[model samples]
Target: MAKRKWLRGLALLLLVALLVVGGMYLYGSSSGTVPPATVDFAKLSPEQEKTLYARGEQVFRAGDCAACHSSPQTGAELAGGVPMVTPMGTLYGTNISPSKQHGIGNWTADDLYRAIASGVAPSRKLLYPAMPYTSYHQVTRGDVDALWVWLMKQPAVEVANRANAMQFPFDVRPAVALWNAVERPAAKPFDASTDALSRGKYLVDVMGHCAECHSPRTLTFALDKSRYLEGSIIEGAYAPAITPAALSGRGWTRDDLVRFFRTGLSPQGVMTFRMASVLDHSTSHMPEEDLRAMAAYLTQDQAMPGPKPKAPQGEVNVKGEAIYVGLCAGCHGVQGQGQPQSSVPLNTNTTAMFPTPINLIRVTREGLQERDLPHGGRMQSMPGFADKLSDQDMADLVNYLRQTWGGQPGDVTPAQVADLVKTIEHGDQ
Candidate 1:
């Protein structure tokens, strides 16, 4: 009698568990109420089509869609082969061109809205959060409509999507429903009518989605709202804090912010890392007025101190100074005043001021590529020194930079550099 009762209890527990999981899957995989299409597709006149196409192009630039969706090899704007490396695994951007076989040519505006706003694709396919639908949850429906018209008009590229390399349970696409139920924010429309500040917030938070990288992630890899824009380490380098206070402390001014966004060059530094793609695809092409609004919103109209050299924090390392003079002083002046339009000055650069020395170390070892920036700004090639410097030498050089100009303690060690190298190599792979 006892054994029979125990078996019955076990069966009842299993049933209850199954019911709970089923409810979660149903709720999580379901799409939210999609907003009505802003324009009637069949009734559009030529003038309306033109207006929407222009607006859609603007929306695409602001959203930086090409940064991830463009082909690295062919430079096709929507062919979609860029690889995004994350802790869970690598995910390639999907083909978003107009090919009916491989792209969204047949998708209705409502389908795009569902994907962008609610993270649900057709046939109840759940997109991984790498798509940034969380930040796009509040995007306006009108913008999506305009984007759809423009996207469909572009020449179709017949490229199929690359398969994802997610590991273990994450490979099970349906399991993403649980993550959605727990962490996904509800889709809502943005209210940009309040003021310029509101418009700026819309551009930065909703359209630009800056916080997706700048903000720290929770253990579940969701953006931690508690530390919004406070900086985070991603893709093996630090995405520095961009809060108003952090910006002001780093000697950033509103004017400089606009200049950087428009030209990819400023006294602060040249754009590097993932931001290089951003400058090429998005900010350089943005309207001046929109750039100003983004800058003003970031600075909150606060009086900025601008760029100033930091005082030396400690005794300089002799070996580090020798390395700088031998290889660096020719381009960057001995006093750290960089050549105009070529090298960036070290004294005012913010890389060393960051809490971690990973960026400094990474850039030093790998160097930067020569490129022409927008608005006639250009930088010469910086050759990588990976084979030239030892781990100890790197630590000493970084320590010297931090102490002399970053106002940071010379505390970096060889062991730390070795560990950070592993991270850098993994990101490169």
Candidate 2:
């Protein structure tokens, strides 16, 4: 009798669990299915079509379509097998080439638009934010159409879509839909009144997706609007605050931004890691007009400015000075004056002068690596000392640099270094 009762109890437990799961799935709904686009390149006049393709190509570069979609293997082009390491799990980029079977060849213009601007797929499935569709949603219709044209023209590859490695609950697609349903309404829209400011807003907020990297996130992983673009830590590098308040003390100007975009170097220092990729693949190739527009938008406080960094208090570390003399001074110079050919110069550099020393710690620990340009030029990568240095050593080293070069205090602690090391080991900042 006890055995029979036990079996009945097990069956009841299983049924209850299923009901709970069913409830969750039913509640987690995505957006409606997107219809196929009606616009066709075949319908346009030859000159008009040519202009679109050209314009689309410009959008392609500005969007840096190749950065995410391009396969790592040489000659793969935009065949799409790049793996993005996120806090959730490893997600691979999908084949976005024009393959009817493997890529977006079958997707309609409306389908593409909705997916880019709404984060919804034709199947009514919510694309993971790992695809940047939340940011992409701000992209304009003309730019989306242009991107569609350019993508369709590229040669399609037969590469298969690699499955994402998300943990369960998160691995469930409906959960992503739930986020979309709750989060979409809150994203601020571009509402600038002036034409120049409006144009700049579109480029920075929509096409450039600047906040995608620079902004900090809430526990839900949504970009924290309260601290938008004030700066954030990224895996393998620091995404600095570009806010006027952050840049003001550093002597950054509109012309300085233009020059940095064009050369991947500011008067302060060289762009490194992903920023370097952005410059090489997108901004460097952008028309000077658009670059100026982007600068204008950033200058005009698209997001309300954060407080400027206060000068830190303290003398340079004695141990950190010894480490720099032995290791870093070979390149950055005895006085932290970096070389002309080095990736970053110490003096007037943005990394050191930032309020927090997380960036300096990150670069020193993990190092920086920029992708080679389409034209075959590549910047030198910073070598990581994680293998060689202790947590206390890093804290001391960074604290010293910030104190001396930035005229800031030595504030980084060994405990923080230990935490950063733990985070970086798990593939995040």
Candidate 3:
């Protein structure tokens, strides 16, 4: 009996040691998160050359590469180091510069294509989803090929890739591989239909990558297919739905979209600094025809889906409402009218009116940077409350806001709150 007990204790120690070693190995493996390997660009003929460069320019616009890669604030064009915050962690956009050591100078065209389309490094390690490989998977082979050619010709710089500040469990690269294996496919093709709108759909679905921001995601970081283009909370800002129902209230016209895409401003109002920043660097450069097609495609009824069914509410929800009144009503107002000129109205605002629970949770936690409001003269900004409020408080506030003013009634689960909290806490948003 004594010998058996001793053996069991030794086995337990071994198990614990194995777990620790496994964890470190997984962590160290992530250090090989380099871009894909280089391709033999000299293999392409002259005719293939012009086409590749042309296609590269198009993909560049659609993917919004310049938006994050170029440091406009620092006047460092394409010497990347932009910070992208998400609900999971803060990702610093790295130098795609051709410098051999600091950037992807050693990468070939094939390496660029693989990274653009699949989000895998040349070393085959899975990239964090924050890089938007899930949406980029839709990019066509031709487009990927073109993008690679274009990126290869760009001037090289020696800026090092920044270390990602993601939290544990999520910081593990093997876990990211698991996520990609389970939630995403190895590849996705553009939808083929004869309609012009369908071609537009192909661009947005694949190359344009609109779904990266527009599509809502589940707690596991998988796209919520049922709610595609239904909008999601990104960083502290809510990427509002492009649906007719969502846009209908905003009174957006096709012309309005055109103007917004052209200059990041329209008669209806501005798209805000974050969106403006996106458009200034990317969308504005897109061909007018493609922009028009994108606008038409987004405005279509077929693109946007309906909201999900509400769950049965229990007595706990009733308790949550009481909590909202005691906490939120002071600033948001009792009638949800908001503090006029000081707070945004929760009843009719585009974000508040949306049925999804994401916006509410996001707003309560991160709060809005009022200065970034698009139509500053017309709208007031609310501060982020992440530090002041608990995850439950945020859920209750969101629940109350959604049920009472958002035109949806569903119980906010603690699990959802916890997941979002983790994302935000980890530096995602």
Candidate that would win on TM-score: 1
Q: Report, for every candidate in turn, its global Cα lDDT versus the true structure.
A: 0.88, 0.72, 0.64
TM-score, model 3 to reference: 0.65
Model 2, span 257-316: residue lDDT tens? 877887777557777666766776688888888888888777874343222333545766
Name the Cα RMSD for model 2: 4.6
Clashing pairs in 1: none
Candidate 3's residue-wise lDDT over 1-429, tens digit each? 999999998997776566545644544433323333333466878887878888787788788876677764564556777778765666777787777887777776666656766676666556677677777766666677677777777888666677888764465565565455567655555656767578668667776677777888887878888998888767645677777666655556666676667665443334453575666567777888877777777777334322222232333356556766776678766665666545655554445455545656655666555543222333445566778667676676666656665556556776788786665454443
TM-score per candidate, in order? 0.94, 0.84, 0.65
Ranking by TM-score: 1, 2, 3
Residue-level lDDT of model 1, residues 269-337, one tens digit each, is: 999998988999999999988999899899988999999988999799888889888878898788888
Q: Give the candidates in order of lDDT, highest first.
A: 1, 2, 3
TM match of model 2 to true structure: 0.84
Separately for all candidates shown, the number of backbone clashes (residues 3 or more apart, or on different chains) is 0, 4, 17
After superposing candidate 1 on the true structure, give the runs of residues whose Cα lies further than 4 Å from its correct spot.
1-24, 27-29
After superposition on all CA atoms, what RMSD does each candidate show versus the true structure? 4.2, 4.6, 8.0
